[model samples]
Target: MTVSTDPGEAATAAPPVNGNAPGRGHRGPVWLALTLALGLLLGIGVGLVIPQFLKPGDTSPEAGFLRDMSTHHAQAVEMSMIAHSASTTPEIISLSSDIALTQHAQIGYMQAWLRDWNLSPTSSQEPMAWMPDAEGSIVNGLMPGMATPEQMTALRAMTGKPLDVEFLTLMRQHHLGGIHMAQEILKLSDDKNVTWLAGTMVTAQQGEINLIDMLLKKLQTA
Candidate 1:
């Protein structure tokens, strides 16, 4: 058995035996102009007119997405932090670091939105309430792509190739679920900032997913 030299290993190592686991677009300046125009219109509607027409309450889709995605991003940051500290491979460590930092920033962005909206970071409703029929394959409450406690424990215990593979697997799934949530929001929301962020997430996460899948195959051969 290969022992892990990961400095963070001890912190993640506890408990055992559980189960497991865990868009692109183009358009030139003309398209960009149209999209931006649409976004401005939506923003104005949300800021000025929409409040009078239909205010988003605590149970609104935006609130639910903010709350749930914050939680979801938290786990990714945690796992990626572990991988960043534990993995022997430089590529894996770098990838994990990028994942951790990017998601960490996103979490902050969402939380700031919550505060700016005068909403609580958490909600009384369930996690996936915003997208009731979105996707059924979720863990714990209803957050998709989250690793169970046991899987996390296992990840903490693993090292080397196993650790890299496991991280890729979990992170890939996590990204997929996040993309799903983002896409769902794009469909349900007309708020310019909200939709723009969601659209950005879909694009970024999909690129990462492709990179992770490629790395997974490369690591499998090593």
Candidate 2:
């Protein structure tokens, strides 16, 4: 809780759980940093070579979904990093690492596609405008299930079981929103690459949602 932005600042030590410190098996900071770096590099390498055989126009549903979902994934990465650095629960630490690495790499692919299409990653169009009847789903420019700034701030200030519970709860909602967008894209787009990635998000996030639910129940009962 009250996580420091400075890498040089030592984190507040979390108490041991079940006779082992949290992050016992988790990657150290150096390895985590390297793994994230490697993931992005690999993503960019693949994205650059992937044939942009079906280039979606600047305002196409494919572009909008990529742009908006990139933004959505960015927040998830931020939240996950916060939890990963501070949570006492081993399950949460590991889950946070997986989410952060996976989404950050996906962002590399999404941005590379936009670059290949000669499109701006940041759009002039309103978020989710490409989806039919998606009006008013955005609140204060935040899309569905995104944590409010206040909630993120609260999450930073929490510790111990509270941090673990809040992270799981928020992430469960985040995954649901992500799955909804991915599903809508699958219905709306026929571009092979876009559909493939969207399908992946739907499947992976749904599975993660199940794990999050199980973890939340265990935390609550404990």
Candidate 3:
């Protein structure tokens, strides 16, 4: 096995198992704007709005969650970019592209939340404080769905079919990790947009996992 050299690795916070949000919540008309903005952020496809609203504070769980999740999603987007270029299968390439596009937009959404809150993009606290049990090998300091440095290095070295398989496998793990985080946020969060997006993440990533599994099986047979 190759070695992993991620600083977040030893810290044991991992982005959030699901994905993380970047900032806390805000009060007043900010809620309306945030709700509308997030809808636009998620776009028409998964931009289903909820009726409830979130509370505001510099360190609110909702804001931190959004900020952290957005950062997590950014890494996923980066990984997807790699897979899009290197995958041998058109299906895999398409799937990777979709992930990149969706998560990149969502990252923008979370960043907007931070700006609305007048909060910094990063937290002074250790990673995954919002998630207490997130102290495991894969559960690094900040990015829950993140792959290790060695995994990234291996992927960079691969070109064709091997690249396809490895990419699918690692991405599957990443999505699964993300799904775990999303499920947690869904249970704990009450903010309309945040909860809705977290739940949607579960649904979308699960379907992708199924598709990825099927792809992997077929590739293995081939």
How far residue 174's Cα lies from its native spot in candidate 2, in Å, is 0.7
- TM-score for all models, in order of appearance: 0.74, 0.75, 0.71
lDDT of model number 3: 0.76
User: Taking the tens digit of each residue's C-alpha lDDT, what string does model 2 give over 6-94?
Assistant: 64454434556676667764557789899999999999987876655457988999999999999999999999999999997899999
**Ranked candidates, highest lDDT first:** 2, 1, 3
Candidate 3, residue 99: lDDT: 93
Model 2 alpha-carbon drift over 4 Å, by segment: 1-54
How far does residue 120 in candidate 1 sit from its true spot (Å)?
0.6
Each model's number of backbone clashes? 0, 0, 28
lDDT against true structure, model 1: 0.84
lDDT of 1 at 213: 87
Q: For model 3, how does the per-residue alpha-carbon lDDT over 44-98 read when each residue is reduced to its tens digit?
A: 5443333112344556666767766777787788788898987667998999999
TM-score preference between candidates 2 and 3, better one: 2
Error of 3 at 86 (Å): 2.2
